[model samples]
Each structure stands twice: as C-alpha cells, then as structure tokens.
Target: FQVKKKQFFRNFMTITLFGAVGTMMSFFTISLAAIAIFSRMNIGTLDVSDFLAIGAIFSATDSVCTLQVLNQDETPFLYSLVFGEGVVNDATSVVLFNALQNFDPNQIDAIVILKFLGNFCYLFVSSTFLGVFTGLLSAYVIKKLYIGRHSTDREVALVMLMAYLSYMLAELLDLSGILTVFFCGIVMSHYTWHNVTESSRVTTKHAFATLSFIAETFLFLYVGMDALDIEKWKFAS
Candidate 1:
C-alpha cells in the first residue's frame, strides 16, 4: 500500500510539473496570437478579463473515463501522470477564471491571494471527500442488496446505474460532479473479487468509457459549430 501510494505521489508530481509547463507554453502561444490578431488585423484589443476566462476554460485537460479503465488493471505510469495532472488543472483553471473575472490584475493583493488559496482547498477537499464518502456508501448499499451478485449481467447493470446516479447526486449538490465519477471508480476498485467477478467490473468500465467518449465527441463537435455560428453572427452585427 505504501509503495503504491508513493508511486501515486510521484506520478502526481511529475504530471503536475508537466501540466504547469504545458500551461505556460499554451499561454505564450495564445499571447502571440492575441498580439497578432490585434496588431496585424482589425481585431480590437482584449482586456485581462477576456484572457482570464479563456485561459481558465481552455486550460483544463480531461482524460475522459481513463480512471475507470486504470482501475481494471495496473495503469501505465504515464497515463497516471498525465491524467492526474489534467484533472487538477481543470479545477484550477475554473477558479482562476472566476478570480480574474471578479478582480482586475492591478487590484490583486494578499487578501485576493488568500481567497484564491481558500477556494482551491475548499473545492479540492470537498470534491474528493464527498465523492469518496458517497462512493463507499453506495458500494456498501450495492453489496448488501445482493441484487447484482450471482448474475453477471445484472451486476454490470447495477454498477452502471449506480455510477450514473452518483455523478448526478454530486452535480445536484453543486460539487465537482466528475470527481464523483472518479471516486465511484476508486471505491469499486476495493470490491474487486475473483476472476469472473473482475471481468464484470471491466465490462462495466468499458461500457462507461465508450459512452463517455461518444458523449464528449458529439458535445464538443456541436459546441464548436455553435461557436462558429456565433462568431459569424457577431461579424454581421
């Protein structure tokens, strides 16, 4: 257990460092583009707020349902590193976005710094704690219910339903709902049984991974088209 945790910590750090570097590189490239758009064309200047919002939303990296996939087996170290970093940065970006929107750069002070730190700690700890507690509770309920056991098909269905419901509960609570999904996977990890039981677990994971992929793909494609349409409409106006 200690060894695995140590590995987890090392993977987390390496991932975070790379994430920071990637964020810096992304900012630099975006800065250059912003400069070119304003100087080399008729595009007007943008304020700090614009940069902050864009930076916040775009800075987040997602690994889809990779955590579930990892729970099925020993995850490759690189996968752990990258995905872990991406998840953390997602919340950080959102928080930074909110902060920048609320206060101008010139107004930043020690109080603002404390507020930012407080926000991060609150979101991170609450998201994880709620996710884990709910996950464990749900798992215990499922185990005692005996509804999914003995029947492979029923068990897979039960897990899927529970995972979906867990995410919804987290969202309804105004928490990081996706983190709940991650915790669901983690709790389920503790319940892994024999060879046959393990296969059922993998099946459910694969199902979620597939569904999440399709959902993300269609959502992003549609959102991209909507964005383009808005851009064109703005130009006409």
Candidate 2:
C-alpha cells in the first residue's frame, strides 16, 4: 500500500531479478555449501533434502528495519526497490520452500524439477489472483453499497475483514498468505481507500498500524524467547 504503483512498475524487473532469481541462487549456493561442509564433519548424515530445506529457510530476507529508517518521500525509487524486493523475496522463498517440501532427493530427474517449478508457479499465481480479486471486490462493495454513508465504523470494519478474509482464504487454499495480504493491501489502498469516508480512512489506517506494531513486537519477543531456550540448545549440542 505504501508503494507507489508507478515506482513499482518501473522497478518491477529489478525487483523480480533480485527477489526470485537471487533467492533461488542463494538457496542453491547455501545448500551446496552446507552439504559439502557437513560431509567432511562428524555430524550425523544429513540428506540433500535436509540441506535444501535449511537453504530455503534462510533464503528469505526481511528489510523492515531498513525500511523503517528510510524516508519513502525522500527516496521513493530506493524505497520501492527495497520494499518490492522484500515482499517478492519473502513470497518466493515461501513458495520455494513449499515446493521443496515435496521434492525427492532420490528422484532427481527433469520431470521432478519441472513439477517443483510448476507447483511454485501455481501457488504464486493463484495466491496473487485471489488477493487481487478479494481487493477489487472490497472496493466494489464500498463504492456501490453506501456503507460509508451510514457509518464509518462499518466501512472500516468491512475493510479490515476483507483483508483478513483474503489472507485466510489463501491459507485455506494452501497458498501464500503473505503474498495474498500484501497484494490485497496494495489493491485496497489504490481502490478501496478512495471509496471510503475520511473518518473510515483515518480509523482503518491507525488500526492497521497499531495491529502491525503489536504483531511485530510479539514476533520478535517469541523469537527471542525461543532463542533463549537453554534446554533446546542443550539437546541440539
């Protein structure tokens, strides 16, 4: 939503190159290196799938902190590049991870690889379509129903619910909820935002911001707590 459509389109190629292609390269490089290193070490035997899974897990990049520090108005191009790449990168990693989950190291054939690629494409495309469709439907409802005329609260609630609905629907269909939500927000900001009342706009903006902050805080807290689990570390070591 924060990303300008013009900037996104302008940098679309670069973003795809870095996000999808670069992520795949990183995954392969990391997996191969881990496999080579582990083969020479005394650790328990790990299959190629295990190394690939680790690669898939670590290939995703989060640039939220960098984005927070960068002023979008001052550097729109750079901001869009970073933001777009981050979103696509995460989505690609997720799809790749899901594809890898069904991969068989023992059956490393062309058909298997093609199937993996097909699955990734299907998930990515389907998730994006679902998000866009949901967003457009939300905008149409707001523009046609006169919900804003009755109460801004209803409009705000409807917007939030539609966003959640898209995410949940994607997850239910075994697609990428992150991509679904991201595109849903973009569409909502473009179409639905203009259709709602000023009060509903402000309320939805602040509510989403507050929810995002809380979610991020909880995410970091959970990660820190998991990292500090001494018993889990002891078992691993």
Candidate 3:
C-alpha cells in the first residue's frame, strides 16, 4: 500500500512538472510562427494576450485520451507516464491562467512569492492526500457492493456516476477535481463490477474516446476555416 502510494505521488510529480515545460516549448514555437506568418510582423510587436487564450484552450493534453489508450491490456509505463504528465500540465495551465487574470504580475514580488509558493504547497498536498483517502474509502464500499450484477448496463451507470459525481464534489470543495477522478479510477479498477452489457469496459472507454476525437476534429476544422477567411479579409483590406 505504501509503495503504491509513493509510486502514485512520484508518477504525478514527474509527469506534471516535465509535461508543462514541454507544452510551453511547443506553444512558444507555434505562437511565434502564428505572429510571423499571420500578422506579417515581427514577434517583438505581438501582444501576449492574443496567443494566450488559444494556449489556455489547448494547453492541457486530455487525460481521458491518454488513459483511454493505457487502460488497454497491453499498454506500457511510458504511456502512463506521458498521460500523467499531460494531465498535470493541463491543471497547472488552468490554475496559472486563473492566477494571471486575478492578480498583477508586478505584485508577484517577494512577499507575494511566499504566498504563491505557500498556496501551491497547500493545494498539492491537501488535494493529493485527501483525494486518495476519499478514493480508498469509496473503493471499500464499492467492492462490498453487490449491486445486482443482473444488468451490466446498470453496472456501467454506477461507474459513470462514481467517476463524474466524485469529480464534481471534489471541485465544490476547492480541491483538484481531476486528481480526485483519477484516484477514483484507480480505486474502481481494483474492484469487481458487472460486465458492461453493450461491451467490455475497455470498449466503452475507447468508444467515448473516439467520439471525443471526432468532435474535436470537426470543431477545430470549422473554427480554422472561419479564422483563415477573416485573416485573408484583413490582409486584403
């Protein structure tokens, strides 16, 4: 138990920290290119706010997608590690954006630095420790539950409720909702549940994941077309 807990923490930290650095690198390059090619101006004159919104929108790699792949029977540690880091970076980006909008950068000086560091320390420790303990408790109840395996469909409902509701509840408490969901996932994975009537859990995971990818693709395509048209008009004018 202790080993697993330690591994989980270590896994969370490495992926979250390194993943953020990598994301910034990609984002920085793309932002520069967008300014150079789109605006026909030097990067030095570009406003940071323009690119910042898009960065925030796509900043975090979707954890569901990564886990969707890793939950498979033959997934590797590298996959999990990358997925974990992506999740962490996404969280960091959102939190960072919130802070940016709420406070002034100039105010981030000495005393402010101490508060910032202290707040993060509190959030990380409290969220992780509490999230895991909550998950473990839920697992204990679920493992003992006999929810009438008579209907696999019903069992899947329970899984969805557990995942979604727990996440929402965690957020209302001002904790890391994603971490809570991930912890719940790990806990739920350890228990026995009715097989999904439509298909296996892996299949369900994949189906939803594929749907998300499709939606993201078409949505981005439409948005890109509109943006390009607007850009061309602006250039022509």
Candidate 4:
C-alpha cells in the first residue's frame, strides 16, 4: 500500500514477470532437480506431487529486509519492483501449492492440467475479490458510522478487528488467508485510514509495527529452538 500507484503501474509487467512466472519456473526447476537427485541417490521413492509441493513451499520469497534497507523515495522503481514481486510471488506459490496438493501422477493429462490451471485461477481471483470486498466494507463502516469522531479507541479497535475478520473469513472459506489479510491491509491503508481520527491513525500504525516485530521475533526464536532440539535429532537418528 505504501507503494506509489503510478510507480506500481509503471513496473507492473516486470513485477509480474519476476513474481508469477519466475516463481512457477523456480518451482518446476527445483522439483525436477530434486527428483533427479533422489533417483540417482536411491532415496525412498517420493511422488512427483510431493516434490512439486516442496518446491512451491520453498519458492515463496520475502523481501522485507531488502525493502527495509531501500530508500523508497530515492529508488521507488526498484523498491516497487521488489515489493510487488514478493507479494505476487507469495500468492502464486500458495496458489500453486494448493493446486498441486490434489494432483495425481497417474491421472496426468491435458484435461487434468487444464483443470489445475482453472482451479488456480479460481482461487486467486476469488481470494483477491474477497479481500477487496472486506476492505471496502471496513472502510464503509468506518466512514459512515462516525466511530472515530467519538472515540479513537473504538476506531483503532474496529480497524484491527476488521482486518482479523478478513483473515478469518478467508480461512473459513478455504481461501488464502495471507492474501486476504494483505489486501485487507492495503485497502484499509488506502480508504479506512482517512476515515479514522488522527490519533487513531498514529496509534494504529505503531501498534501494527510493534505486533509485527513481536511476531517475527517469536517466529525466529521458535525456529531456532526447533533446529537446536537434541531430543528430536536423537529420535530421528
């Protein structure tokens, strides 16, 4: 959402190329390489779908740290390209992973491939629309209800809850909750941000930043702990 609209449009093609097409290429490349290596190594046989799923999982890239170091004002095009690519890459990977989950090697055919493509399109489009709708609804509620005029706390709370609502609704419908919440945030920043009180805007911004930092901290901490778990290693051995 912080991305300039004009800049985003200007670099849209590049972003899509690197994001969607590149991710798919990476997924297939990784899957094929893994399959070849495993075959030669005589490792236990694994299904093609399993290898593709793993590829999809690892293909999603995060550009948060890169973007943090980038000066958006000075390098708006570069920043937008990287940012947009990261977003699309993640969405494409998730859609690909979900689509591949139902794949069967024995059933592989032109029709099955077409069906997979159709399902991917359906999930991507539906999830995007759901996110946009939820964001618009939140904006409408904040604008028409005048909650911010009375209490900034209610305004802040409403925005946060609505964001959560979008995620929950997406998950409930078996859609991509991450994409839903992402678009929800974008919409909220675009529309709902203007509807809220000034204090609420500042408060909400800091609150979300703090929450993000805490979440990242815990995520890395847990990952490190899991990696260092001697008992788990012993059990596997």
Candidate 5:
C-alpha cells in the first residue's frame, strides 16, 4: 500500500482502539438505547444483559468486504483503518460475547464493569503476545533449519503449515484465534519472508493470493444464495 510507517502505525492504533474500546462503548450505548426505546413503546420485555450480548454479536465487522471496497481507491489511511478495525472487532466481539453471555443484569455494578474491562484488556494483550511469539518461533526455526535452502515446494509448504498451526494452537489455548493468526501473518511477512528463497517467496505470494481470491468469491456467492431464500426474508421486514 506504500503507507508511511508512522502513518500506518498511527492509523493502526486508531483502528485498534476503535475495535477494542469503541466496540465496548457501542455495545453499552446500543443496549441502553434499545432498552429505553422498547420500554417507551411498551414492547415485549427484554433482558438488558441479553440485549448487550446481542450488541456484542453484531459488533463484528466484515473486514473482507471493507478491504475489497476500500483497496480499489489506493487510500492507505482508510484501508488501514478499516482493516485494523475489522481484525480487532472480531476479537473484541468474541471476548465480549463470552464475558456477557452468562452475565445477569441484576448484578451490574461499577466494580463488575471494571472487572469486565480488565479481563478484555488482559485477553487482548495475551492473545497478541501468543501470535507474535508463534511467528517469531516459526521464523527462527525456518532460519535455523535452513528450510529455504531446500526445495522451494518444501519451504512453501512449511511456511503455510506453520501459519495454520499458529491459529490452531491459539484456539487450543482458548486465545483469540483470529488475532493470533493476524499477528502470525504480520510476523511471517516481516521476518520469515526475508529468509525464504526468492523462488519460494514468489510461489507463496501467488499461491496465497489465488487461494484467497477463490475463497472470497465462493464465500460471497454462498452468502448471496443464502440471502435469496424467501423463508428467511421475514427478518428484514
């Protein structure tokens, strides 16, 4: 994207803050507003905690769609913001949903809110560390084992496998798999990428791109088809 390092970092921070803190704030706002509106209208009674859980569920942004729309304009700041927010949003949604799913509205208090925020911060930081460490370890192993000096196919396979491995391990450890994989990708690109043979590097790049394009194409196609079902159309009305 040719974004300046400082600008990229600043934008990344902004989007990340939106993803984490912004999502939490949005959840609370939506919950309170929905409760107020419903109460005023004398609608069916709803649990505040349940409404908050719904808010968490909807906080997840589709980064793929955001990136696809923004990337065409060559706007690095907007692209970075959308991309970063989408990533963090997914992780935040997961953590927030899990934390609030079993929560009781009657137990709400200032101390509980503080503890919830504390848990979210801790989870975010720990998951990030797990991802970076996995990437670093993979890079170190590839360099020490001289995998790149071997067959290009083997190098490519090893790198791709390690990336998936990080995600799996993160899930096994009850960390945010999405964030772990995200950081793993960043680390692999920055560190391990330089260690690979030129042939393997090109191979990996093209392979990943082709696979991603195909995946996204089919994913959207399926979504479109799913949405066309008349039986499920009542929700929109």
Candidate 6:
C-alpha cells in the first residue's frame, strides 16, 4: 500500500537480480536434483527434460501469499524483496519456460547454454522495454488530452484501458504480457497517476487495491481446491 517508502523500494535492484539470475540457477539445480532423486527412486519414467519442465513451473513465485502474510509494518526489506522478486521471477520463468519447451536432450551442450542465456537476456530486455514504452505512451496521451480534467469515471476507464491494452498488445506481439503489465503499472504509478484527475487518483488507488485482493484471494482458493481434488490426485502419480 505504501509505495512511497524509500527504504523498501531500495531493495528493488537486489530483488531483480535474485529473480532473474537466482531463478535460472534454481531451475537448473532443481531439475538436476529432481532427476537424480527420481532416477534413484525408480519413479515413473520422467527424464531430465521432464524435470526441467516441472522445475520451470515451480520457478515462478507469486508475491500475493507473502504480502498477505507480511504486513507493511513488518520488515520492509523482506517485504520489498519478496514483492520485487515475485515480479521479476514471473517474467524470468515465463521466458525460461518458453525457451526450454522444445528443448532437445541431445543438444544440451556449452553452446546451448550460452545461447539460452543470450536469448533469455534479449527476451527480458525487449519485454521490459515494451512495458515501459506502453506506459509512457499512455501517460503521454492522458497528459496531452487533459484526461485528468475529464470526469473521474472516464479517467478511471482510460487508465484501466491503457493498462490492459498494454498487456494485450505485448501478448499479441508474442512478448511477455506479465512483464509488460508489471512495467506498465510501474509507469502508470510514476507518470500516469499524477496526470489523472485528482478525484480519480484516490478512486484508482482503492480500485487497484481491491482488485488485487480479490484476484489474490480467488487464486489461492483455486490452488487450495485443486490440491484437495481427489480425482486429480491420480494424475500426479
């Protein structure tokens, strides 16, 4: 809720690095370890590629759980780190997952590793730029059109529309929509928020908080229900 906290925001760089590099390392480590363990245990026939796929799935972390548990009053560093890492990790894992989706076991070599890393960096940078660009563009339009002077309802709609449009545009272009939306939010907060109508500014803030809470609640509930689904348990084995 308190985005103005400098101390909390200072952990952004550390969290970004952890989410990007740390996630990739963890994916590899977990996949290799899982393969070793599964092979030893003679579990169902799952090879290294399968483990990698599974690792990719678990690499992305959601900050909703962490944020819900740790209030703003608690350790700011931990909260910021968790939030930042969650954002970065989601973007990283999406790129990593897509990169490894069609991976060939026979082509696993030094060159493949280098290529993967190169592609990952490119994807991350491009996707980030897409989000920032969209956000800036939206902000510019609002400022130029004096959207804030308009009705508060119209301002709210414009803001939400720009945000969702950025996401859809990124996905349409075969880019990372998650990263695009994340960066779009950043741009909106930094630029567009100020350009919005004064009345709508407060409305937008509460709207975001409420929507985020509802989405997070439903997400966790869905996960919990899925976990308890006896019918789907057989698929795991």
User: Largest lDDT belongs to which candidate?
Assistant: 2
- Between candidates 1 and 2, the one scoring higher on TM-score is 2
Estimate the TM-score for candidate 6: 0.89
Which parts of model 3 are misplaced by more than 4 Å? Answer: 1-17, 20-78, 129-134, 146-150, 191-237
Model 1 local distance difference test score: 0.61
Error of 6 at 102 (Å): 4.4
For model 5, residues 164-227, the per-residue Cα lDDT tens digits are 9888987888777878887888788888888788898899888888887899899999999998
lDDT of 2 by residue, 1-237 (tens): 556888988999999999999999999998988888888995898888999998998899888888889888999999999989999999998988888888898998899989888998999999999999999999998888864554788898899999999999998999999999988998999999999888888888888888888998899899999999999999998
lDDT computed for candidate 5 = 0.78
Off by over 4 Å in 2: 146-150
- In Å, residue 142's CA in model 3 sits off its true spot by 2.8
- Please list the residue runs of candidate 1 whose C-alpha ends up more than 4 Å from where it truly belongs after superposition: 1-10, 20-47, 61-75, 98-107, 192-199, 219-237
Candidate 2 CA-lDDT value = 0.89
lDDT of each: 0.61, 0.89, 0.57, 0.86, 0.78, 0.81
| Each model's backbone clash number | 0, 0, 1, 0, 0, 0
Over 4 Å off, model 4:
1-6, 146-148
How far does residue 151 in candidate 6 sit from its true spot (Å)? 1.4
lDDT of 4 by residue, 1-237 (tens): 356767876888998899989999999888889888888988777888878887899899878778889988999989989988998899899988887877776788999999989988887888888898999999999888854565788998999999999999988987888778877888888899888888888898888988987987788789899999999999988
Pairs clashing in candidate 2? none
TM-score of 2: 0.93
Ranking by TM-score: 2, 4, 6, 5, 1, 3
Q: Write the per-residue lDDT of candidate 3 for residues 1-237, one digit (tens) a residue.
A: 101333445566666657656666655566666656757654445455556545555566655544655643354455657666766676555544443343333455788757754665555566566556665655554446677244556555666666676677767877667666666666555443223333546554664567667986787789779778976888867
Better of 1 and 4 by TM-score: 4
- Between candidates 2 and 4, name the one with more favorable lDDT: 2
Estimated TM-score per prediction?
0.67, 0.93, 0.58, 0.92, 0.83, 0.89
Clashes of 6: 0
Tell me how many residue pairs clash in candidate 3: 1
> Which stretches of model 5 miss by more than 4 angstroms?
1-7, 37-46, 146-148, 233-237
